[model samples]
Target: MADPFGMTELTEILRTSIGLDADVRFDGELAETEFAELGYDSLAMIELASQVQRRYGVRITDEAVLDQMRSPREAVDFVNSLLAGKVA
Candidate 1:
């Protein structure tokens, strides 16, 4: 099945959640970019996760998985996997 959420939409969601400056042009393609590089700390990740849960109805309760999500692409892939029933 195709991803319910496209990468662009996910990127926008991530950008909104991260609250980047207007002038700060997020390339948004650096899928491997670490959250720390984007000035996101653990709290930010938690907030992002909460946002994802609220928006996608997918609860990501695993701390390890959360910790492993280093970029918006990773989060998006995880969410898509959940939506596809590829993850439990």
Candidate 2:
């Protein structure tokens, strides 16, 4: 199995996907911070999902991206769960 999907990796992908960078460090606050509040939109979230699928070979739907993976913490947990066979 691959390494666990984590916030640091998500942060990097998100930064590139949105074409901007912020000081959203990985912390309790950041974990719960919504992408919209970070100045990122659904399209950017879609791009992040695309990058994750390309790099990890795991596909998560845009609906899932919008509904479930609203924040970096949620994304990390969701991807790790999928990678762990916890979600089919």
Candidate 3:
């Protein structure tokens, strides 16, 4: 199995999903920050899910990204669950 999904990877995908420049650092705490506050809406979440699927070979549904996942930390944890086959 691949290594666990993490913030660094998500950071890149998140920035790209929102069309932010790669060099743009996220202001405030990343784990605590909501995706909406960071400029990601439903569409962006779907895009993030797509990128993650392509890159991670993991299938995270748009519904999971939109409804289950919230902050970056939640995303990481949710992804890890899927990766570990422990999602409930």
How many steric clashes between backbone atoms does each model show? 0, 0, 0
lDDT of 3 at 87: 39
Error of 2 at 16 (Å): 2.8
What TM-score would you give candidate 1 relative to the actual structure?
0.72
Number of the top candidate by TM-score?
2
* Tens digits of lDDT, candidate 2, 32-87: 98878877888888888899888888889989989888877888888887787845
Question: Candidate 2: misplaced stretches above 4 Å?
Answer: 1-3, 20-22, 86-88
lDDT of each residue in 1-88, candidate 3, tens digit only: 5546877777788665657655755434867677788777888888888888888778987789987678787888788878778433
lDDT of 2 at 1: 58
Model 2, residue pairs in steric clash: none
Which window of ten consecutive residues has the lowest lDDT sum in model 2?
A: 15-24
TM for every model, in the order presented, reads 0.72, 0.83, 0.76
The clash number for model 3 is 0
Measured with C-alpha atoms, the lDDT of residue 88 in candidate 2 is 54
